[model samples]
Target: MTPFLTAYLQRIGWTQTPDVSLETLRGLHLHHNGAIPFENIDVILPHEIDLSDEGIFQKLVVARRGGYCFEQNGLFERVLKEVGFTVRSLLGRVIIADPPDMPPRTHRILLIQLAGEPWIADVGFGGQSLTAPIRLQEGIEQATPHGLYRLQRNGDDWILQFRHHERWQSMYQFEMGQQYQADFVMGNFHTAHWPTSHFRHHLLMSRHLPDGVKQTLTNFHFTQWQHGQVQESQTFADVAALYEALQTRFGLGVSDARHGFSLQQLEAVMAGFAQHDEKA
Candidate 1:
């Protein structure tokens, strides 16, 4: 096996044949969602998100770390291609607010064709990420481990919705327009460094637990979700508690030593943000 393919499968905990069938696609998607978390610590720490395949592999696989949409979907796109699947990258606008607003195309997703049928595969959206690939059937509620998700046709665009609080809530929208690599590069730059970007201001981490529970840690607060609603929640008392939650809840390691931010430094930096929060 090629080094990249081997490491990619190992990272996602996939031990099956690398085929382009629907079963293989579902397995890859589900395994990836369960294994790699969605996090933005690099952006919070002011570290630039490298979009290169080698950079992503080294950081996420070799260093045992996680990343945001661009990094996660970027790496996933390459893996799908290496496994003989025809994959194309697409962009989407997050519209979670009350009044639906079309933000910049900041999210990355994949469109894969198998046996002349198209499916949407995404394992990157932190809180509302789909745990399995959904066919391109509009208005169909597809059951997944987390919850039911559907795609609604909105004029020329398609709105992705997740079942939350027993209601269908809009997550994002995308068109079939061909997206280029430059679009993702620009989006990543804005998301990583823009002053008002949430990734720049907060520490967010998420992992879909094997027990059908979704665990999320944002700043000092940790929340668990099951069947589309919050089941339990807590706020860490201190940086130490937050560190423990990081290791236990999200399965993040102590630190990315290659980035020069040791665990102590991480605690100090997070403390700085907490103090700033109080002052604000």
Candidate 2:
């Protein structure tokens, strides 16, 4: 194995030999979701979202950092292919906010084929993401560590929904269109550079915690959910506290060397969070 792949395996604490079976796929997916965080600090800081292999390796494995959907799932696609699994890149939209129209295809997911059976695997959706692979069947509830998820057909597309508050809410909608490298490049560009994009302005971070809890850091607010219900919540008093929580609680190993956020930028982001909190 190459050093980058070795470091990636070590980063996820995967000790077993890799195989192209469903068991390995589930194990790697779950381990990755729990190990690496879903963070959009680069977008918030207006940094480069490099999707290349070397870029991903330096940012994720070498630097011990995390990334948003494009970077996270992009690297995962490479790893899955290296392990002999047939993986295809798929795109989806974010509908959790109840937008008036169909949102753009900003979310990246994987469709892996094993023994002629297809499955959905995503570790990049920060809040309430899937922790295990799900079959590509409609109206079938697939159980994960977080909650129950199901996929329903909508014309030529499929809507992914999660059981929330005793109701299945639409998370995203997408067709099984084959995604290319340029497709993700365009999506990443829009998400990372567009002024209207929430990711470009907000700090979003999340990870699966032990005992089947979901922990998320939205701006400076920290929340823990169990079975889709908020179990614990708190807000950091200042940027320092927020940084500490990101390091200790989220395991993001954020630092000046890794993030390269200037003091002015940090203060500005903190101020932005404070303003949002005031409005809330």
Candidate 3:
């Protein structure tokens, strides 16, 4: 195996795999989601989100930091290609978006054709990331370690939904198109710097446990889910508590090199959230 692939395997707590099979894909997806959380700290810090290959590897694997969809799925895509898998870069329009009526394709997803069958894999949808790759079948309720997800047909596009609170909530919509790093670069720029982007407004981090439990932190609100139910939740009273949860709970340590932020800056952002809440 190549050195890059070797280090990536080690980062995700996986030994070397012999081949690119369905079982291997599932195992990698599960392990990757658990170890690397989905977070938007850079967006909140207003730092430049480097989407280059070397940049992503350094920020996520070496620095031990979490990132949003672009970095997370982008890394996964590179890994799968290195492992001899047929991977295609795809984008999705987030359903929960600012312009709720029609949103841009800011979500990065992968489509892999294995054994003559196509499957979707995404390790970066924040609170609702898929823990396993499901086949490209419409109306089939695919079960992951955390929840039941399915894809549906919508006029030439595909909509992904997860069974939340006994309701199939739509996550995003997509139409198969060839996407390159250049495409992601433009999307990442808008997502990171756009004034109205949701990533700028709130702090979001998510990770799933090996035992089918999901933990998500949305600003001060932290929630854990098990068996598709809310297992535990809490609201942090201050930035100190929030910072602690990012390290201890989500495995993201916010030192200068790791997360590129200090506690004082984090406190300032939390104060902004409070002010925004008051105005609402």
Best-matching candidate per TM-score: 2
The C-alpha RMSD of each candidate to the native structure, in angstroms, is 2.0, 1.6, 1.8
Please give the range of 10 consecutive residues that has the lowest summed lDDT in model 3: 252-261
Question: Per-candidate TM vs. native?
Answer: 0.93, 0.95, 0.94
lDDT by residue for model 1 over 34-127, one digit each (tens)? 7888998888776787888888888877777888889888888898999899999999887877444568888899999989989998989998
lDDT of 2 by residue, 63-96 (tens): 7788888988888998999888999889999998
Top lDDT prediction, candidate number: 3
- Per-model lDDT: 0.84, 0.85, 0.87
Q: Looking at candidate 2, what is the lDDT of residue 84?
A: 89
- lDDT, candidate 2, equals 0.85
Off by over 4 Å in 2: 256-265
TM-score (C-alpha, index-matched) for candidate 2: 0.95
The model with the greater lDDT, 2 or 3, is 3
| TM-score of candidate 1 on Cα atoms, chains taken together | 0.93
In candidate 1, stretches whose alpha carbon ends up further than 4 angstroms from where it belongs are 99-101, 229-231, 275-280
Error of model 2, residue 141, in angstroms: 0.5
* Residue pairs with backbone atoms closer than 3 Å in model 2 (clashes): none
Among all windows of ten consecutive residues in candidate 1, which has the lowest summed lDDT?
Answer: 253-262
Model 3 vs. true fold: TM: 0.94
- Model 2 per-residue lDDT at 249: 87
